[model samples]
Target chain A: MKSKRILDALLAPMVAIIFSVVLASVILMLFGANPIETFSKMINYAATPRSISLILNSATTYYFSAVAVAIGFKMNLFNIGVNGQYRLATAVGALVAGALTFPGYISIPIVIFVSMLVGSLWAGIAAWLKVYRGVSEVISTIMLNFIAIGLIAYLLAPSMLGVQTAENVVGTPVIPESGRFPGFSIPGSQVPVYGMLFLAALLGFAYWFILNRTRFGFDLRSVGQSPSAAVASGVNVKRMTMYSMLLSGAVAGLVGLPLLLGAQYSFTVNFPGSYGFTGIAIALLGRNHPVGIAFGALLWAFLDVSSQILDLVGVPREIIVIMQGVIVLSVVIAYEITRRVKVRRQQDAVGKATAVAQ
Target chain B: MRRVIKIASVLFAGSLVLAACSSSDEAAVEENAAPVVKVGLAYDSGGRGDGTFNDAAAAGVDRAVAEFGVEVNEVEAADADGTPERAERLRLLASEGYNPVIAVGFAYSDALAEVAPEFPDTTFAIVDSVVDAPNVGSLIFAAEQGSFLVGTIAASASKSGKVGFIGGMEIDLIKAFQAGFEQGVKAVNPAATISVAYMGPAGDNSAWNAPDRAKTAVEGMIDKGVDIVYAAAGGSGLGMHQAIAAAGGSAKGYWGIGVDSDEYVLPARAEFKENIVTSMLKRVDTAVFDVIAGVVNGSPLTGIQNFDLSRGGVGYSSSNPVVSAFASVADGYAEKIKNGEITVSSTLTE
Candidate 1:
């Protein structure tokens, strides 16, 4: 029975993968490129050692974003403002880090903590709006993204960050070199130490533990599953909602640390990328499970990294976007199908047992 | 049912094998052809069809295809979310025989650094950022040089010596433009006050993409007794132009200066052709096309190429009717700057 359940658990993702490939192939056919060739090239490119490093690097941000989104999902909340949270956090982190003259050991952690605090504050505003003003978090967070962008731009502009020279255009003063995270080199390859991957994994495990083992986790989940029931059980639903959003923002803040401290070491206008929104897809694909999210992030990263070959094969890069959309759509459909199938099987067994008793 | 499943799995596996074999065969055919030059372009967050930077860069690719008759491929990143996606696209293009890939924004610097060394044979060109690699060409522009000219134009044309400069973001790059414009305005008309307001705060630089907000900001500037606003706000600058056009009062002759490509005659802003006082032309297309041409002609410059006013790579647009009216004044300033008579320093410290 356990083996069957394991098999069933695996089937949905497998079917989703198969359906995604088929859908991609159909689209490729319409574009007049041989789908087999294109897919093969993509697979081959993805399997390389350098590609593995790239995937790992990409997954770090993706995983964190997914965790942030998943935390909100657990509270029946949609944190659409992870993007805004990340932007605010990164700016705060970058500015604070840039201002400090501390050694690497003290500076990096302080920067990261400040970033998390700022990110939480930004997200907490949305939560406050949702709880007090009866505004939906989904709308509030989305609107906050625009406000964050505007504010950041205004602050970074010449009169504030002290535009030094032409060479440092579109960036804050470079974080002191001592404050940057050192890169670990992989032997026989140019890919640097993807230390952020391990950090993401640790955070994922922590998230999983907090969600499954702790009292706050239980309260949060209970509130999500049934707010009325949670209220009756003495859980503060509004407080839990606010806490979940704050936690979500904190997780999202970490998404920029790797880039700010490890690679770029300075804040650019669009430095964090779109990890916030992409994390939503990753969270859904993983079904809000930590381990599942890691796998989902890896798969998404692989597809993203591999699809670069589409251009070389005379296929429009937009097709990869279509494939991504199809994959997400198919996975959702497959998940629903498996769920319905399980419910139907249970009903059938119960009906048979009743008939026999009669 | 199990037998059917087995048969389907076998068919799928067969197709996979066939696909792999055919792709290899096609790759061999491509290899056998004339040294196929693969060029990869990592667009800005707006991606292609933005009718702005990405579109201008893609126009360079189109020119390469038409002029050199080389095989070309472009990757349009959906948004900033696709940084690694851009690098991956470069790697894929490299593996598939695309040489001399171009990443079109400063955003791709780190990604290029990570991906460039993996394929040493593949030459990379990144616009607006310096990546120190033997095979990489960093295309940077002296935006300040162009901004100086436009600032002079704005100052000379303004009736109210109080001109305005609305920027998309508050980065050093935009600051450089602002500084240069301020300097030029001071040089031409020292009494002219330049009120600067950026669209966003510190880090979130989405001001370049939001046209409505840009229009509002420009309108706000105009309301404060300022005319002839110079906008370096990317697509958002379009809003500034629109606002200027709407406030069609003769005494309040609000003019706008466009950035990057020449927007004075672009089809998108046909209505504001007359309202455009001047534009700071960064010439991204010229740089891109030149590099692609170099790749074709076997003379690609594999180091930093700084394009300034002297190179004709970055300058003010002389084609605009409004700008042409100030031909003698523009010429005088241009000659003075070129001949070391007027020095335009890029650093705030200077």
Candidate 2:
């Protein structure tokens, strides 16, 4: 039984990868580029030390984002608000870190914690709206993103942060030097800092523990599978739903820590990127499994890093975006196929057993 | 059992074939002739095709491709928060033989600092912010110099003694433009009152790109009896222009001043071209093209390249046919400003 389970686990990802490659090829051909060349360039570019570091850096944020989205997924809830939650958390954390001067060790943790709290709070607002007003999280979260932008903008302006120089640029004060993450050089290359990857791994393990080894996780999964069943089993479905979203937001908040506390140490207008949306792709790609998420994050990082190399090879960088969309679609289709196949086999086995018993 | 095993083996074999097929095709391409110069462009959040800043920078890249036949790769960082991702993207380009990577906007400054030294052989250029790296070239514009010229125009054209300055973000860079505009207005008409309102605060810079907020801010200024408004905001400037059009020939004839590359000529603002008193031309495209030109000619400029009004890098747009309507006033001030007769000071220290 154990061996069969292991085989199934390995086969799933392999199948997904194969499916993604085929889909990517069709996309490349549509764009009039050879699929083989594009995929090869992607792999070769990701093989380098610098490219590896870039991949790791990209993955750091994806881990948190994937886990956050996955939490909502487990509850059969779609938390499209990860983007807003993350933005709010990052803005608040950056403000807190930039405003107060603290020692490096203390400040970094405080900033990260504050970010998580702020993110949770932001998500909780939507959860509250959904629970009390019967408003859908999807709609509320989407609207909240615009509000988050406006609120953050107001706070970062001269009247609030007061960090602007004569240029009237809206950005927080630079975090004190002690508060910044130190970069460690790789043995032979000038590129430094691989610490964030370890941090991501640690977070991944934490996510796994919470999902599989804890009561809260069990309740979340039970509720996701069937709210009526969970209620009959004495689970507080509404509370669980709210908590799931809050927890998801908290996890998503961690996405900005590496960027904010790292070498830059300051929050700019473009600090959040599309990490919130990209996290959705990571969660979907990983099938909301923690281990799968880690791999998905790495794959995403690889694609992003490799796309730059594609530009060097005379290919448009936008092709990378097309490839990402293709990969996601292909993985989803492959998962559906696998699920159908498994169901059909199970039905066949059950019918044979019934005949033998009769 | 044998049937199941056979199916599994077939699936595995199919996967291997797929992977192999993709890898082999790439190998064939590399075996061919090497590509020429590889240039990577990292655009701002608005991305390329926004018909704005990113598009302007991409135009310079496209020009390089056409002129020198250099292989160009362009990526849109997509959002402000994606600087690290964008930086990582640039580093990837460097690793793959893209020698000179150009990151458009000051937002990439922090990322450039972390990534530039890692690839010392790879040269990086950042527009708007200065990075202190040997190989990194910081291309900055003297926006204040241009703002000063437009401020003069606004002061001269306004019937109301009250002028307004609408800024996108409250940054030191944009502040410089505001300060310069204020100074220029004061230089021409000492009694003119200049009210300054920024679209966003210090912590968030989206106000620079928010057209609605810009329009509201301009409308508010106009409501308070300010006739001529100078906009240092990017896309937000479009709002200011729109607000001017909306207030057409009202209590006080409203005039708008444009900024960043020449909004007076952009197709998006073509309708309001005549309403614009003048534009503070930042010339980012010209600077970008010049760098590409340098790279192709084997003499890529390094270190900081400052574009000031004195060098014609930053200044007011040429007397547009629309400006001809206000020609007498514009020509009068142009002569005075050019002949060392008027000094517009934007710096707080000055």
TM-score of the second chain for every model? 0.85, 0.81
Which structure among the candidates has the greatest TM-score?
Answer: 1
Worst 10 residues of 2 chain A by lDDT: A162-171
| Candidate 2 local lDDT, A1-358, one digit each (tens) | 9999767766756776676677667766876888787778778767777666667777877888888888887887777778778877887887788766778788778888899999999999989998889998878987887788778767776557736421223467877777776666656544555456677788888888988999988988898888899999999998998899889889878877776676446666656645777777778778788888988998887877776667556455555565566566556656667778989999999999999999
Which candidate number has the best lDDT?
1
Look at candidate 1 and tell me the lDDT of residue B320. 68
TM-score of each: 0.79, 0.77
Q: Which 10 consecutive positions of candidate 1 chain B have the poorest summed lDDT? A: B23-32
What TM-score does chain A of model 2 get? Answer: 0.92
- Score residue A239 of candidate 1 by CA lDDT: 91
